[model samples]
Target chain A: MKFAVIVFPGSNCDIDMYHAIKDELGEEVEYVWHTETDLSQFDGVLIPGGFSYGDYLRCGAMANQSNIMAEVKKAAAAGKPVLGVCNGFQILTEAGLLPGALLRNRDLKFMCRTVQLKVENNNTLFTNHYEEGQVINIPIAHGEGNYYCDEETLAKLQANNQIVFTYSGDNPNGSLEDIAGIVNEQGNVLGMMPHPERAVDELVGGADGLELFKSIVKQWRENHVNN
Target chain B: MKKVKIYVTLRESILDPQGSAVKGSLTQIGYEEVQDLRIGKYLELTIGDTDRDIDTIVKEMCEKVLTNVVIEDYRFEIEEAN
Candidate 1:
């Protein structure tokens, strides 16, 4: 399986994502620029975390208009797997690849710490390895990490089982229903505020995040083998 | 020459930690009447043409970058300035 990490001007976590995939997963990973339009060679795309476009206008706001997002949207529409983390999540929401939106942290400050999140729905391709209600620890760092949506849309997300992750214990960012992450209707695209890539290695303090990547690669390999 | 105002706010289900923090500070300062506080974003855009559909543009901007619809809701209005 191959991984492609999109790099925007202010993206600081692309290398972290790249290393997590290449060094740990031992998978071939490529850093794709936000201006690159071609994605025919990659199997999956990872939009890493960071203050893209300096979080101007809003978090992930300006970065969503980057030239490469058009192709990213195309790939997402085609059912390609895409994982967006932190600022990437904001970008995905802005790009309409995912439902809902991220808002300012209710504290009006940049929250940086490990947060416990529950695997609200594990049936999706993104959370197949986690059991429903299982708690996972990941770091969330952002000033505008709150998530918002209308009641009708929220009901639809619940009905479709599109929500993938929810905060456990006390809600951290004031996200609706403590939503830490979510997938699109097709379940191929995922956007979350927590930094799973940062917790993939044990030396970094925890290895809980490694399972997500493993699950994806494992599913991809299994699907290919079965076909 | 039209004007539009957009109001964006976090849904009720979501907690307003910042608002709560402010409320706490207010209470510490002895302003206890403040029951609850909610924070929202407001945008006022000026459209040069009076008949143009500023609502659509405002909504698009909200979707594209103005607001994150996942956790927030936005409503807008267009009016002629007196």
Candidate 2:
């Protein structure tokens, strides 16, 4: 499936995302500028992690206002798979595509390390390749990834199984309920603080995150072939 | 020109670890009895003459971009200029 890796000004991880798709996944991938007004050609969307807009105002706040985000919303409403990692996750929440907000880490430190993530739900488009309750190691680097939501919203998210991943052993960054990743109510959009793209190769580090990209492609092929 | 001052703070329900760190430092310096502390942002905007109400503009900006309604609470004041 074709993928568009959205590149916002000050975004540093765009190259990694593009390489993960083009070289590792052997898929059609392109770097699309954040100001572009169209995303109709891409079958999937990936928003990589970085200090977009220099994390000015707030993480992902300014990038959420860019013209391309409107197209990202359109692609999401069309039921296309949209994956956002780290700062990308921040933008998704800021755009209201995902619920809750990422607050300052409980210890007020910028944490950068490999973390264990438990697959809370494997039925969603993003985590279907993994077994329920499976554990995977992914890297997380951020100063503000402590997720918080109102009690009512948390209850709703739990009832709907919108949560997709939780920290396995120890909750890094003190995310509420150890939530490391989540899908939207429709199960199309995913937002997570961990760097999956950074884990797609074993030569560099671990390749546990390769399954995530493969899962998206597998689902896309099934949907198209069935239709 | 008109001056608009905006204050944005994490909601009471949310935890402010940064603020608490500062509070701990305060206690170390012998400022005891400080029961609570929080940190927030202050922003200033200068607006040119416009037909829309200043309150309306500020509110729209605050709700949309200046403050994240999901995690923050904001208040603003307008200072009319000569």
Off by over 4 Å in 1: B1-82
Q: Report the error of model 1 at residue B65, Å.
A: 5.5
Number of the top-ranking candidate, with lDDT as the measure = 2
Tens digit of per-residue lDDT, candidate 2, span A28-75: 999999999999999999999999999999999999999999999999
Residue-wise lDDT of candidate 1 within A1-227, one digit each (tens)?
88889999999999989998999899999999988888878888999999888887678778888888888888888777899999999889888888777877766778999999899888877777778888988988888888887788889999998889988898877788889999999899999999989988888788778878887887778777665
Instruction: List the candidate 2 regions with Cα displacement exceeding 4 Å.
Output: none
i-RMS for every candidate (Å) is 3.2, 0.6
DockQ score for model 2:
0.91
